[model samples]
Target: MTGGLEWAVTTDGQAVTLRQVAAQAGVSRQTVSNVLNAPERVDPATRLKVRAAIESLGYQPSRTARSLATRQAGLIGYCLARHPGRSLFTDPFLHALTEAIEATGRRLLVFTAPEGAEGLATYADLIAQRAVDAFILSDTVDGDPRHGWLASRGVPFASFGRTWPEQGEQPGRWVDVDGAGACAELVRGLHSAGHDRIAFLGWRDPVPVGAAKDRQRGWRDECRRLGLPEQAAYADSDSMEGAAHAAATLLDAAQPPTAIVAAGDLLAVGVISEVRRRELRPGHDIWVTGFDDSLLATSVEGGLTTVRQPAAEITATLVRLLDAGPGRSGVLLDGRIVSRSSAPLDL
Candidate 1:
């Protein structure tokens, strides 16, 4: 192997480091950096010496170390983890978030959960690898430990659909819509439509208490606020199949609900489909509502009534927080109820 060709350039006798390059060039490390970053900042003679030394030593800066110095990676991490058959690509909220994150001069590095992953493994693996400068946590959990872990490690993170706990110290790092408030609005909209027994359909407990859990919490709070019938409350697996089956169960209950507020658009669409299957008119027999404005929401010919959260507004806030170096730590975005055939337009 050694006799074939001596293509190996020996680092043994050459200095391939910034420090060595600077030393050989008879300049400080800062001067060499100035020559590369702001050539005008250094005198012509000094710049020439640094350039010559860099060439002579064949010095190549490590991307990781360079990113550390610049505080920007030109890439952003996006964690995409959900169970099978989930409508990820069809989700408008996620697509909007993706475009928004990309528009900020950063690329999205998606990290999906490996087979059978649970708990904090995603966060740990990402941090350990140091593959991204910061991470975009979509549909994060309430009181999520990932945020705390990132905070302690000083790694930046942003949430899309869900919210984390208030840091008390830094207050604008995460982005979220008012899940609870949106649910309340849906219930009130149903209540005003001559529908008294309104039910909430959500997944009782996802691996992490994601935004669906927040919506369920909203359902509970709204039930207390409006004094609507509570026994009809139900949960699915945050999927269309789960929601469809759950809707059937609700229909079989002793006293079926007249209207349903789904935690997600897919769930609501399932309810709507179920209503039609039962020969019950969507708006009359049972009003249906959803969140996220996903295809499941507006995909129906007449459109499904939903609470629309502005992805641009929330994502801008998140990108701002990340770009500004975690100076702020949390944000609660608002949602608005959109009138459609799925739910009566009482608002």
Candidate 2:
């Protein structure tokens, strides 16, 4: 080999190209390209020849060069809509998803979108600019306008939320957590606990149409099935402190519920705090359960019964869907029911 900063000149000192390789290997340039790309498609005899040439000439094709030759970027971009702490979604679960996306040999360009028409405008700009080859829409909504918008532009996009999968042009590219099913489970567990008076504590204002609504729907359906009245409680404030205050008020009702379900793990923590202050045991006096199964669950004095949506599974799923786009492929991982000191047998 020639020294550094110098070309590796052959005996003839002539630059080598695909034609030269093909002649030397007694094959064709197309054969070389096939071996470089869809190696399985090339005949074994041709593949061996191409490999020999590749090694002899020290030929290395960069991804960008391959894209130029094939007119494809071989890159995909995943985005999360801008909503307060855009980074939180990527903190772990989404961060895992990001890794899974990369494990499939694709690049990730994560960003957020603003709320309202401005969000759409931002999406439009990205589409116009062709900022990404594809996208993995995080924080999706029911009947998400972004889904329809992406379809209109003929850009391939997959979502972690299956909002309009049943009615979308690209009905096969969605992945989501089953919020409704998760709620149903909570109901079943509560019913098994001999709790008839079940209350659902959720956000007061409009929440995401996906899990946010599904949770309520599940709560209502379970209550109706169990012949229990639906006692819905909500907090106007968005802060954890606010949720805690709301929990206090709900617990202080004329007839406190035997069980309370919160939409978020934080809300559950808040409720547990109030439950402690009220001189009541969390897993005993009142069986409390929360979702998301965050780190806060175990740290608390009393262990909380929660549904653990592991970030690893969610991230792996996101990666699979990103790699296998334009086709229907998904797996709804089961939520873990972490039993704790609370949720005593209905004795």
Candidate 3:
């Protein structure tokens, strides 16, 4: 006997029921269920007894039945952005977010949806079908409509990016990395290395919004604060090809910057490529830095210096906000600069 209960072997391949577990533990069916669902409400002795009875009877609660009873689907919905030539699986942040959600005993349900009206429709459809308990949003932009749609309908949701004030006065709960702060920190590092001529290569958003804008703002603000010329800033597509062309423009200028800070790793790679093509060495001739600390950043010959987002912490905080429900204040976590040969900083 274990835990003062005899372990019983189920016969004839019949599934053990809650009633059987209650009978074995000398408790009522309600007591057994309380132990399973809300153990805090049950005393330690009774809870242990019910747990022992459950193990001995080999009882497994039906998820479908539990959902019906609790009105929770035990699923968190996430809408995958269908960006052309981009796979969501390649992003480490998504991997961390997935693992964090599963750690909470909840599964992530991902569905692809195009941006705009169709994406909103997909969210509505998921709610209509009762396919999810709540949602986790990412890639949020200024004046995003999804947050308002979810909030107005009284749905519970948390975002991985900030729901900008353009969306409304009271944006939904969110967790976002401080892109501006990360970029400003990068600038400070470069300045500490005695490089005054600094340039910024950032994504060209149709509207001045999102992370790219924030990062650019940081570079601009820091440069002005240090009295460094900020005229070297340029905006281009997030692709390597676009960044390479933009880097070429900056390099060919009359007064080129000694160091360039790209908004992302891919853009930094482009700058490095352009720098090498012109018979210039990265750390020797021109200092380079990037954000995201992605695989490409590490794969570079000298390990590109970049900003590392706190993916695990961001996801954990997102889960906490979701658990707390809507109307919770947002969280903005800082990113750390990972120093390397590209732009070594005496951290």
Question: Which one wins on TM-score?
Answer: 3
| Per-model TM values vs. the true structure | 0.69, 0.75, 0.82
Ranking the candidates on TM-score from highest down gives: 3, 2, 1
| All candidates: CA RMSD (Å) | 10.0, 7.7, 6.1
Per-residue CA lDDT of model 1 for 1-347, tens digit only, reads 11211122337685356677779999987787766555666888898899898778876444456567565666778766565346433255556666777666466777776433254687677667666778776655555556666767778776564433433543337677788878877777677767788887876554344566667778778888888778444444666677888889888898999888887777788888888889999887888888877656668958899888787787777777777775555677778888798776777
Model 2, span 1-347: residue lDDT tens:
11111223353565656666667778877776666555667778888988798678766455565456555565556556455542223366666776676555556776666754457776676666655677777676556677667766667777776664353443546666666677778878888878887788777776644566767787888889888878777766545676678877778888888788877666777778788888898877777777777676676775667777767777776666655746555456666667766554332
Give Cα-based local distance difference scores for all models. Answer: 0.70, 0.67, 0.80
Pick the winner on lDDT between candidates 1 and 3.
Answer: 3
175 in model 1: Cα distance from truth in Å? 1.2
lDDT of 3 by residue, 80-177 (tens): 76673342223777788888887776789998887866689899899999999899998777777888899889889998876565533646788888
Query: The CA-based lDDT of model 3 is what?
Result: 0.80
Deviation from native of the Cα of residue 49 in model 2, angstroms:
26
After superposition, candidate 2 runs with Cα above 4 Å error: 1-61, 86-90, 124-130, 164-172, 322-333, 342-347
| Top candidate when judged by lDDT against the true structure | 3
